[model samples]
Target: MYRIGELAQRHGVNNDTLRFYEKHGLLQPSARQENGYRAYSDADDRRLAFILRAKSVGFSLSEIAELLSIEVDKANRVCSDVKELVDDKLVKVSQKIIELERFRQSLQILSDGCCGGPHSAEHCTILQALESFEENDPR
Candidate 1:
């Protein structure tokens, strides 16, 4: 058996993460020591590892909980669900990539237009461009 701190240290997770998992029902109830401190078993360590691995792969807590609740015999069903979640995340990731590329292009344009020589704000093209942007932007 391990105390909460020991379990956290063994798993390389913070105590708050373990407590959050318990609060979210991702972890089973912990046994209590005679002094009322929580005691964890090897099974708890396995469960925490599973949760961390799932999170590393981009599974949300709720999604991981659903996946964990699935019976071992329903492997195909679990696979389908996980696949759908991954596909959705992929779409969002692709959109973000596009947005970041656009932002990079805009920044490049600003940098390219700026004069490298030292200049006052009143004569700076970069500042002028920023002022124009502020005037044109609605928010």
Candidate 2:
């Protein structure tokens, strides 16, 4: 049996991380020692590894909980169930990438409009653009 610290150290996570996982029902100790320390079995170690791996791939705690539930009852789950979750995440990620691209384009426009001159800002294109408002701006 491994102590909590040992397990956390092996996993490169803080002690509180382990406790948080336990509290969130994502993981648990196999037993508690006589001295009141948590003892983790190999199965617990494997479970922790799974949790970390899921997190590395952008799964939120709640999503990871869903995955863990499915994992615990794999016999009743089809592969499409897991694929659908990934597909949803992919859509969200793709939307974020598009938003970021638009932001980059806007910044580029503002940057290209400016000469970056050392002169005063009285006639700076960037500043003027910032202060100018167009119709139908909605605010």
Candidate 3:
């Protein structure tokens, strides 16, 4: 068994992260020592690894919880259910990428329209375009 600090250090996460995971119901101690310190078993270590791996792949806390439930109840859940969750996340990520690219293109247009000289902001094309967009935007 390992103490909370030892587990956190071994996983390269802050003590607060371990506490937060506990609060979020993503992690639990296997037992407590007489001094009131949390003790982790090998199973806890494996669970932590699963949580970290899911987070590294962009899963939110809630999503990770769902995944964990599915994993623990494997007799009732199938691989297709996991694939569906990943597919939804992929669609959201792709849409965000498209929005970011559009934003980049707009910024590039503003930059290209500017003289980029050492002048005052009284007649800056970038600022003017931004103001125009703000004024004309329906949203």
Candidate 4:
């Protein structure tokens, strides 16, 4: 068994992270000492490692919770259970990349339109383009 600080140190995470994990049901201490300190077992270490791994792969807390739920089910295989979630996340990430690239193109257009120096605000092409887009955007 290990104290909360010890466990956090061993895992290279903050004490608050351990507490937050406990509060959010991502992790649980195995027991409490007489002095009211939390004591963690090796199982807690493994769980924390799993949480970290999931986080590194871009899983949100809610998604991690779902994954943990799947992990506890004896009949569910990990690969099949996790594949759909990962696929969905990948789609979302791809969409974000496309949106970001579009945004970059728009910014480039604005940058190319603007010839910066001694220009009045009313004569700024960038400002004019922004106002035009704002008024014309249906979405």
CA lDDT scores, all candidates in order: 0.83, 0.93, 0.94, 0.90
TM-score of 4: 0.82
Candidate with more favorable, higher TM-score: 2 or 3: 3
| TM-score against native, each model | 0.75, 0.81, 0.92, 0.82
Candidate 1 lDDT over 75-132, as tens digits, reads: 5575777677668877887898999999999889988998868667687777889899
Off by over 4 Å in 2: 115-139
Model 3 deviation from the true structure expressed as Cα RMSD, one decimal place = 1.3
RMSD values, in order shown: 2.9, 2.6, 1.3, 2.3
Q: Clashing residue pairs, candidate 2?
A: none
> Sorted by TM-score, highest first, which candidate order results?
3, 4, 2, 1
- The worst-scoring run of ten residues by lDDT in candidate 1 lies at 70-79
> Which pairs, if any, clash in model 1?
none
Clashing pairs in 4: none
Model 4 C-alpha lDDT versus the unseen true structure: 0.90
What are the per-residue Cα lDDT tens digits for candidate 3 across 98-139? 999999998899999999999999999999998998999999
Candidate 2, residue 76: Cα displacement in angstroms equals 1.3
The digit string of per-residue lDDT tens for model 4 on 8-44 reads 9998999999999989998989999999999999988
Measured by TM-score, the strongest candidate is 3
Q: Model 4, stretches more than 4 Å misplaced?
A: 74-78, 116-122
* Per-residue lDDT of candidate 2, residues 1-139 (tens digit): 8999999999999999999999999999999999999999999999999999999989899989999989999999999999998899889989999999998998999999999989999999987887774543677
The residue ranges of model 1 lying beyond 4 angstroms of the native Cα positions read 71-78
